[model samples]
Target: MLTSDTDAYYSPGHVAQVVAQTVERSRLKSVIDSHCGRGALLDAVEKSFPKIHCAGIDLDGNAISHLRKIRPHWTLVRGDSLAWTAWERIHRKLGGSVDVAVLNPPFSMGQVKGVNIELEGRVLRGSLAMAHVITTIYHSNPTRVVAVLPESTMFSEMDRQGRAELERLYDVEVVAQFKSSTFRGARANSLLVGMTRRKRQRAASSVEKAHYMSLHNAIVRGGLPCFEAVSLRHGVPFVHSTDIKDLVRGEAKESLRTVRPFTRGIVNGHMILLPRVGVPNKANIGAWFTEDDVQLSDCVIALQYRSERIAHAAAVNLRRDYEALASLYRGTGARYVTVGRLSEWLTNARNTRTYAQL
Candidate 1:
């Protein structure tokens, strides 16, 4: 079956066989494949769990129609796996949430620089795939869940919220981690994860849930203004990556150049200049603190805070978490991270286990 291709990958028959065996070992009586594609997993599932009742949900009508004909005993529905209504239909058919959920959720979501997915009033931002697994855990309330996800799903800055929530709600166990070429014609690093719901814990209003809930409102974007227009003399003083050589070299910063400010008046307070584009490494990762109200070029990210101590603390925190933050920038090209991801990273670095965690 052709995949949705946005971020979803249809698990091959053999791959599904492996994942199904893992679920079968859990001895679950009922299972739901939230992103079931053409019933590949379901096919292997039938053999793996003969007595278990199975249900599958997918956005593809043809796949659901095809399954209805081929697997008459199975309950298959054509609708979004992310929508509440879709799950409602599945719940009605199954008599309640299933024992376990099998998932091959969408990954990366490369099209959007940032992603936000909310369920049951809790929101997860960053990776669409993480949101899928986390949401399934929330909506299904199943005892166990097994999913095929990107290897970075547990660590990436973009999926931090999902990871945090999962850790909070489940006893996570890694079923398997696969090579980038594990799936034919697919190059993403993948993994199989199994999670069992914890005993009736306190609700999300607990201390940890309050912290996780606070991250949903992390100021991801628009915190720092980008300025590109520049001139030799007339406009406000501006700093570029090249100008920060001495600062990086443990030398005093020289006079900065000038650029047109994006704001109407003088840019106020202490500013932080960060290199937005570069390869991922320690030399490339830094927290360049600046004291000018000057405009900064687009090449560098300019930020401000109400207090100088806060700005200094932020810079120190970013540098402290440099290695983890650098992971956010991946691939062979001149990698870059968006302001939103960076903001989320900084926020996570300080309070929660998302990065630094006291």
Candidate 2:
């Protein structure tokens, strides 16, 4: 039967559990609970480690008063967290860097009207201001930060830039997350993020590892065979996947013109017949032309694939590897087709067939 005026309040047991978990995982000699609502978090930390120093700060005087009455041993301050100078002053008074900061800051997303305000002679949004203060502390003191953030902030695509900034400045990791209807009588999801000050090189390695593991898991769960069957040739002039459909349908008016056998190349998953030289001025007029009209260059290469398998006993040699196929046709002035483009061609071809049947 605990009640509070805070936007989001957790049960004492839940807060104690989270604080205990954070204490166990982080090297927290001293803890600062920003937006400390009722001092439940402070009580939990002190209860777990009596020797560990703890402080609580809140903008609400009533909350701070209540905290002081309940836990007179804990230091309670009334101040806005977004005040950089005040925050720095408090940090200085603490004598040294804090080991950990645990916060359940106000979820001011919809409740607070964001205003463009001047801070240190720079204009910044209120929401961004709060983030800036947190980032400043993170940069100044390599403290471990564990905070509960709105689920929207964690998952919204629009916050990609903000998320990237946070990740760059901190060894940001989501330790645990869950959905609960704990805020304003509405079901709001939240994430508990754990962060530590990371060196530039170490942070890069961490980001790479996260990306690699995510990609590996996705590939495994997708149940798709490894794309080891495909090979890529950089800097190939790509035609849009849709353009392949027009070419295959003979819908390309240029293909209608009878041009000299200028050169043969593979295009859009099929063989292409182009003049040895291209037609000039006829560029606007989509038609094939004679070699004299165009210049032959290595720009275009023929992409060839085995229409049928060749047996070893036959004069035709069998090539199984993509690299081997690329090497064999390299001197022949042929290029390789990407599997993605090939798939697009196949899809369009099927669509064309379906249309014809209809």
Number of the top lDDT candidate: 1
Residue ranges of candidate 1 with Cα displaced over 4 Å: 1-8, 24-26, 108-110, 200-358
Query: What range of 10 consecutive residues in model 2 has the weakest lDDT sum?
Result: 216-225
How close is each model in CA RMSD to the real structure?
9.0, 18.9
Q: TM-score: which candidate is best?
A: 1
Q: What is the total number of backbone clashes in candidate 2? A: 4
Root-mean-square deviation of candidate 2: 18.9
lDDT per residue for candidate 1 within 125-202, as digits (tens), equals 757777678767777788878888876675444565566677677767667766667766678777788887778654
Q: Residue 34 lDDT in model 2?
A: 65
Alpha carbon deviation, residue 205, candidate 2 (Å) = 13
